[model samples]
Target: MTLGAVAVLASVLAVSCAGVVLLTEQALTADLDQAAALRARDVASLLPAGRLGTTVPGAGEESSFVQVIGPADQVVSASANVTGQGPVIPAPKDARQVTVTLDSSPLGSEPLRIVAVPVHLPSGPGWIYVGTSLVQLRTTMSTLILLFTTGLPLLMLIVAWTVWRTLGRALRPMEAIRAEASQIGHSDLARRVPVPPHNDEVGRLATTMNAMLDRLEASSRRQEQFIGDASHELRSPLTALRTQVGVALAHPDPEHTRDLLATIDQQTQRMAALIDSMLYLARTNRSPPGSLTDVDLDDLVLEEARRLRSIGGLRIHTAALAAARVRGSTVDLSRMLRNLGDNAHNHADSTITVALTTDNTTAELRIADDGSGIPPGDRERVFERFTRLDQARARSSSGGGTGLGLAIAQQIAHAHAGTITIDDGDRCRGAVFIIRLPLSAHHGP
Candidate 1:
C-alpha cells in the first residue's frame, strides 16, 4: 500500500511539473516576441530622422539584431552584429507585427525570433525587422527542466519516507494486538489485547476483541460445567444398573432375576431419557429453532393433558382451552407442553390443570398443580439444568424426572421469542408455570 501510494503521488507530481515547464516555456516565448515587436517599433521611429546605414544608438545589443528594409524587401540598414545579412525576415506589407523564425542567422546559426513591422520611412513605406536569439530562453527552459526532473524525485522520496514512518507508527499498536491475540488459547482467555491511550480505531478494535473474548470465556466455562453435570447424571443410572444385574446374577433365582430385569429396564429408560434431553439441549444450543410454522397451542395443551392423565392417574382439566396460534416449531412446542405437564403431574397431589388463553399479542399457556408451591426464592432455580426442588415438591415418584425437563422447556420457550415464569396457580393454589408466546398473525379472532 505504501508503495502504491508513493507511485501515485509521484505520477501526479510528474504531470504537474511537466505542465509547469510547458507553461513557463509559453510565457517566456510570449515575452520574447513582445520585446522584439517593441524593438521594431523603436527602430522604426528612428528611421524618420536618421540616415540609412547610420549606426543607431542602443541598437547593438548582443542578443538583438535590428534591420531596416525598403519597399522591394532589400536591407537598407543593419545592426553591427548582422551588418551584411539580408533582411532577417521578409518585409511586412502593413503596420501589423509578424513573428518569424530564422533557420540560419548571424546569431551563431541558432534560431532567431524576428518580428517585422511595416513603417512609413522618409523615402517611402518600408518595413523594420527586429530579431532576438533564443539561446537565453532555451537556457532558462533547460535549467527549469533539469531542476524539475531532479528535484521532483528528491521531493517524492522525502514524502514517501515521511509517509512510511507515519504509517509504521500508526500500525504499531495493531501489530501488538495481533501478537497478543496470537498467543491466546482456549485454556487462557483472561488475557486481553493492549489498548492504546488515544481513543482511535485501534483502541476500539482492541476493546471489541476483548469483549468477544470475554463472551467466549463465559461460554467455554458454561460448556465445561454442562459436560461435567451430564457426566455425573449419567453415572448414577449406569452404576445402579450394574449393581442390580450383579446382585441378580449371584442369586440366580427366576423371580429375583425378573425383578432385576425390570429394575434394569427402568434404569435404562431413565438413562435414555436423560441422554435424549441432553441431546435436545445440545442441538438447540448449537442451532436455535429454525423456520417456524403456526402451531395450535390449544391442541398441544389438550394432547399433553391426556397423556399425563393416562400416565400419572391425575385429573387433568382444560376448561380455559381456546383456539390460540403461535409461530414456532410444533415438535418443540409439544416438548415444552409435555415437560410442563410432567412437571405438574409429578408435583400435584391429585389434579393437573392445563389452560390456554390469548391476549392482544401473545398466546399464554398455564400448567398448574395442587401440590406444595415452589418458594419464591427457588422459583428461578427450578429452571436450571440438573436442579430438583425436592424441598418444595416431593421426589417420591416411581420414575423421578432427570431435572433437565424444565430447563429444556425454558430454552424452547425462549427460542420461540417467548417467556416462561413460575407464579401462583389461580385454581390449584400451587406453583403455576406460565408460558407466553407471540401470537401468530394467522390466528383467528
Candidate 2:
C-alpha cells in the first residue's frame, strides 16, 4: 500500500472512532452531573447553614469532598478536602434547568462533573454546590482508551499487510514479463511474454505487447529478405557491365569498344533504375507516423493525365469524377499516381485511359492500357518486387521494365488503407489497375 493510502485510512478510522467516543463520554458526563446536582441540593437543604461550613480534621474531613454556595454567591459550606477546589460551576440562573461544564480536559477532576442548584430556605433561595467523584468514570474512560490504543496498531498492521500482498501479486506477472523481455532483441524475436490466464487490464496489456512483438518479428524477417534480394539484383548488372568493359579492353578495336560502351551504358541504366526503385521503396517504409491528410483524388488523377498527355508517349485520356478524395500523405499519393502513369505509358500499344470515379462509400482511380493483358494467375504475382512478366523484360527501350513500379504502387496504396486491383481494360486486351480508397478521406462541411 502507498503511504498516502495508509495515512488516509488511519486518519479516517481514528476520526470516526474518536467522534463516537467523545459523544458517548459527553452524554454520560451530563447524566452523571445532573444526578449529582439533584442529590447534593437535597442533602444540603436538609442541613443547618452553620453546620454545613464547620470542618472536621480527621474522620469527617477525610471523607468531606463537597461544597455549598449561598443565595448571594458565597461559599457558606464546603467539604474540607474539596474546599476552594473543583470548578466554580454557577448556579442555574433561569427557571428551566440546563447543563454546563467548565473544564476542557476529560480527566480534570477525580469527579469530573460538578453542579450548582438553588434551595428555598426560610431565609432566602440559597444555592448549594454539588460535585461527585469521577474515579469510576475515569476508570471506564481509561479502560476504553486503553482498548483503542492496544487494538489500533494490530488493525493497521493487518490492513497494511493485506494491501502489500495484493499489490505484489498484481505486479508479479509484469515483473517476470519485464525480465524475459530484457533478454529479447533482434536475434531473439521468437521469445514472447507469457500472458496469464485471467482476463484483466494487465492481461490485456500483455496480450497487446505480444501481438506487437509478433508483427515486429515478421517485419524484420521481410526487411532482411528484401535487402538480400536487392543486393543480388544490383550485383548482377554490375557484373555484366564489368564483363563488357573487360572484353572491349582486351580487343582494342574501335567497333568492339563502341559496342561494349553501348552495352555498358545499357547495364548502367538497368542498375540505375534498380537503385532508383530501391530508393523509392526505402521512402515507402520511411513514411512519417501520423501524417495522413485529405487528398483530392479526382483532381490528382486528371492533373496526372493532363501532364502525361503532353509528353506524346501515349495519348492520356481522362474521365474524371468530382469529389474523389482520401486521407493520405501527398508524397505517397503522388508517387502512386506517377508509377501507375509510367507503367501505363510503357505497356500501352496505343492510348492510356485514366478513369476517376467514386461510389458513395469508396473512391477509385483506374489506369487502363491498350496492350496484351496479363494472365489471371500471374496478375497478383507481377506486383511483387523484382518480378518480371518475361515478355515485358524482352521489350525494347522504355517498354522494358525493372518490375518494381507495380510493387511500389501497391505499397503506397496499402499505406493509405487502400487496395490496388487489376481487371480487363475496355475494348483492349490490356490490364486495368483499379485503386480504391475509403470515402472517409472526404473531410467536408
Candidate 3:
C-alpha cells in the first residue's frame, strides 16, 4: 500500500513539476519578447522624426540592441555591439515586420531574440530591429531543471519512507492479532489477543476480537461440559443393561431371565430417551425453529395435568388455566410441557398443580409441586443438562428421569421466545417453574 501511494504521488509530482517548468519558461520568454518589441518600436519612432542617431544608447549592451536598415536591405545605422552585423535580421518585405533568433551574432555567442518592425523612414520605407539576450532565461531554466531533477527524488524518498513508517505502525496491532489468532485452536480458546491502548480503529478491532474470543471460550466450555455429562449419563443405563444381560445369560432360570429382560428393556428405553433429548438439544442450539402455529397454552397445561393424573399417584390440579394462546412449534411446546410435568411428578409428594394465565402481551404458565423446594442458589443450576439435586437423584433414577428434562424445557421455552424461572411466585411449597411466552397476536378460546 505504501509503495502504491508513493508511486501515485511520484506521478503527480512529475506532472506538476513539468507544468511549472513549461509555465516558467513561457513567462520568461514572453517578458523578453515584450522588451525586444518595445525597443524596436522606440527605434522606429526616432526614424520618422529624423532624430534617429547612428548609435542608440542601449546599443551593444547586454540588455538590448537596435539596428536600422534602408529599403534595399542595407544596414543604414547599427548598435555598437553589432557595427557591421547583417541588419540583425533581414529587412521587412512589403512593409511587413519580421522577427527571428540568432544562435551566434556579432554581439556574442549567446542566443538573442530579435524583433523587426516596418517604419516609414524619411529616406524611404525601411525596418528597425531590436534584440534581447536569452542568457537569463536559459540560466533560469537550467537551474530550475537541476533543482527539480535532484529534489524530486529526495521528496519521493521522504514520502515513501513516511508512508512506510505510518502504515507499519497502523498495521502493527493487526499483525499481533493475526499471530495470536493463528496460535489459537479449539483447544486454546481461552487465550485472547492483546489490545492496543489507544482507542483507534486498531484498538476497536482488538476489543471486538477479544470479545468474540471470550464468547467462543465460554461456548467451548459449555460444550465440553455437556459432552462429558452426556457421556456419564448414557453410560449408567448401558452398564445396567450389560450387567442384566450377563446375569440372564449366566442363570438359566426362566423367571429370573424374564425379569432381567424386562430390566434390559427399561434401560434401553432410558438410553433412547436420553439420546433423543441430546439430539433435540443439538438441533435447537444449531438451527432456528422450522415452523410455527398458534397453540393453546392452556390446553397444553391441562394435557400435562391429565398425564400426571393418569400416573395415579400425584393429584393434578388445573383450576386457574385461562384461555391463553401462543405462536410456537407445537411439537417443541408439547415436549417442554411433558418434561416439566414429568419433573413435577417425579418430585411432588402427592399434589402437582398446573396453571396458565395470560395478559396483554404474555402467556404465563406455572407448574408447582408439593415436594422439597429447590434451594435459592440451585434454582438456576437445576436447568443445566444432566444436573440432578442430591435429594432428587434417587427418585430421578427410579422414575427414569433423564436429568435433561428441565434443560430441554428451558431450551424449548427460549426457542419460543419465552423464559423459564423457578420461583415461589404463587407461594407454592416446592419450586414453581414459571414459563412466560409471548401471547399470540389474536387470542381466542
lDDT of 1 at 414: 96
Q: Which stretches of candidate 1 lie over 4 Å from their true place?
A: 35-62, 76-85, 91-98, 101-111, 117-127, 133-136, 253-255, 288-291, 311-317, 348-361, 366-381, 391-400, 421-434
- Output the number of the lDDT-best candidate: 1
Q: Select the stronger candidate by lDDT from 1 and 2.
A: 1
Highest-TM-score candidate: 1
lDDT (Cα, 0-100) at 44 in candidate 2: 58
lDDT of 2 at 340: 83
lDDT of each: 0.83, 0.72, 0.82
Instruction: Estimate the Cα RMSD of every predicted model relative to the unseen true structure.
Output: 4.1, 6.5, 4.1
Model 3 — TM-score against the truth?
0.80
**Model 2, CA-based lDDT:** 0.72
lDDT of 1 by residue, 1-445 (tens): 6788889999998899899999998999899988888877777767656754545457788888888887777777878877777766656655776888776577787778887777877668787778888888889999999999899889888988998998999999999999999999989988899989989998999999999999999899878988898899889888888877787777778867767787777788888888888889999998979668998888887787778877856788889898998899999988888788778887888888778888889988888899888888998988888888783653322223888889999999999999999998755378989999999999886
RMSD of 1: 4.1
